[model samples]
Target: MLGAMSIDLVDLVYRFRKEEKEQHQRIEGVYWVTDLTRCPLKRTYEFKYPELTAKDVFSPVFIMGDLAHRGVESLIKEFFLDAASVEVEGSREVSLPNGRKVIVRGRADAIIDLGDNSKVGVEVKTARADLGIPQQHHIDQVRIYNWLFSLSYSILFYVTPDRVTQFEVRDSVDEEEIIERITSTTYPRYPWECSYCPFSVLCPHKKAHDDRHR
Candidate 1:
């Protein structure tokens, strides 16, 4: 009887692992940034909001204002997806060079069942008017998602509060430029990042660094 019980327990563990894998397959998103860098700024800002010198400029208002905007993005993207969704496959956690885990999280704004003309990934960007149709930076972001998720193609949606702009990625669009831009940053700035940029105030790169003995 004890031997039979051990077998049952092993079977249960196997079933549990299978179920977990299936559940992960059903959800299409990557949480890789978590492994990249430990974002102390977000933690510090949330904790010391009251004592912050820039409290007035940075308020809970930013949070409140984005709620509805985020809602619109969700609704539109879900509609585009119809019902079925894509799932993240591997490397959700990206480890940064500094040995910190920068939690990277992303989902398809919408996944379209293309039938025969199906594309792999779709990205939705909310932005103001007069913005360019598609930039190298935007392409790089989408390409990373597509590559990581094992998707063949990606679509870029630039949506405003009123209108929607769409662009598709193909093979011949100077992909090298996009990759280069992603790898190099000659001019980095603050006050423009969404919430994830790590080098806002404490980055020595923002100032001039002169290394002698070259």
Candidate 2:
């Protein structure tokens, strides 16, 4: 036995870290659908050089968002209990025309089935301020969910301290566009993403406009 030293050493921080690592290992090779849509360049970079893409800075808002996800999940579970609804994450395999297959996955806040094998995908989010309806990036994300789950409709909810704004979107897919974007030699979308990325300094596709490096 290694003795009481090991047993007494465990603390909340250490235990949470240990468990988080174990949970991450479950999806080591797969790309997260959410992350992919946010920044394909970073996604591709991380996929190519996983070791160099370690998270360096932790944002408090990001942490708060993680906690918010749990609260939203619990609330969804309670609301959908008596109704004929499904509130859960879903995953599907999508094959590119260029002969590549990827795992596209996401979770809906709540999916209320309206009969005839139709589902409504729901996405929940917390923001510092409500900026009207869904952003284009968000619209792109839920449409991907529609592609994955064959959802008939989707809704994006942006909640703030004082108000909640929602946007409803229809099902659409553009795999050709996504495939071309991800496989491109340059970063074509969201140059500002690099400014906030931890890998900005090291990324080859990083732009001069990325002020984080300046």
Candidate 3:
């Protein structure tokens, strides 16, 4: 049944052309593996506040310390125009292949702009003593952070209980011997080997070697 209707075929064509003219396509940026890996770490750190769960005995002391720390941070922030803000880029929990879950969160205390065209990541370690880490272990920690966060360099801020010396997190460097040790699938050197390691007494391999030597 063909009825004599004014079929506006040209109007339909004009509408189609208008619809196809200059449309903006939303493009999603591709994220790398390192970007995805940071999510777990971010979640872990943000959720678990160990201090909050702990008893209130240490609360006042912590608050006081934090106050003092923030003051120093304010001064440091003024120095870097590029990295003027201390932002929590990511804080999450990450899982290892061995099924152990670790909170891998890092807050950039203050990023220092090198003035030319560079930046440095600062991590304030406010403590009574220096964070004594096995050389190889320290290198691994720094190296991994450097790679993941795309940091050119980092600073380790160490503060004493007395506040005698305000420890600034500087590029104090890790040695090549530590690098060599990291590459090798072996134990640490003499002095480091003799250090009070938690794994020592329980190490069956170490016990066996000692027995054989005896």
Candidate 4:
């Protein structure tokens, strides 16, 4: 009976130890557009309990996303604006009201020539499945690039294992709102967000799920 109940202890402990250091970083000292959109509580936990919340587990989906991005990025160089045109690091800097420095930057996957003097920014993403066009977080990412470039529009591509979908979003990301969010305190902030957060169990604002559904 004891043997039947036994699980792979080595893998379990490896996973536990591996997760201890993943995504562990200082929050307030720096910021990314994701922190403002992907549940502020996630950022809160990463900052507040960096050790406990880090998850270093291997995710094939994440690996696929990376491979997809790299493949697409290489292809777009020949047809559109080359990789040389984009900045990868947080090279562009924005100064806050309190003299705090924040950098605004992302590796604009590509820039498309509109044939006129104008151009559109591109962001490529790979997801396990199609959530929908303009998924909020990915939108936020591209919108930030648009804001930085002050372009009239941007494109988002979601490549899943099954298919690819594209969306053209207008340059409407609120720079002030983003600034406000980063300055504000971190809480889970939204119940829906908690349902998807890794730190939901430890989150003070995490909503109780209905056991009946389970």
Question: TM-scores across all candidates?
Answer: 0.44, 0.73, 0.40, 0.69
lDDT of each: 0.46, 0.64, 0.42, 0.63
Worst 10 residues of 1 by lDDT: 28-37
Q: Residues 1-214, candidate 3: write the lDDT tens digits.
A: 5598778865664454344332311112222222222222222222344233233323455555565567768777676654555633543344444554443333456666665755666555454444342233333444444543556676655565654333222233233322332233334232343233334443332322231211
Looking at candidate 4, the ten consecutive residues that score lowest on lDDT are 82-91
In model 3, how large is the Cα lDDT of residue 110? 61
Off by over 4 Å in 2: 1-22, 25-29, 48-58, 82-87, 185-188, 208-214
Cα lDDT, model 1, residue 84: 39
Candidate 2 achieves a global lDDT of: 0.64
The per-candidate count of clashes, in order, stands at 19, 0, 11, 1
Model 4: residue 105 alpha-carbon error in angstroms? 4.1
RMSD of each: 14.5, 5.5, 20.8, 8.2
| Candidate 4 Cα outliers beyond 4 Å, as residue runs | 1-28, 52-54, 81-87, 90-101, 112-117, 189-191, 208-214
Cα shift from native, residue 207, model 2 (Å): 2.4
- Model 1 CA lDDT for position 111: 54
TM-score of 4: 0.69
Q: Encode model 2's per-residue lDDT on 32-76: one tens digit a residue.
A: 556656666666666566655344213457556656766776676
Best by lDDT: 2
Q: In terms of TM-score, which candidate is stronger, 1 or 4?
A: 4
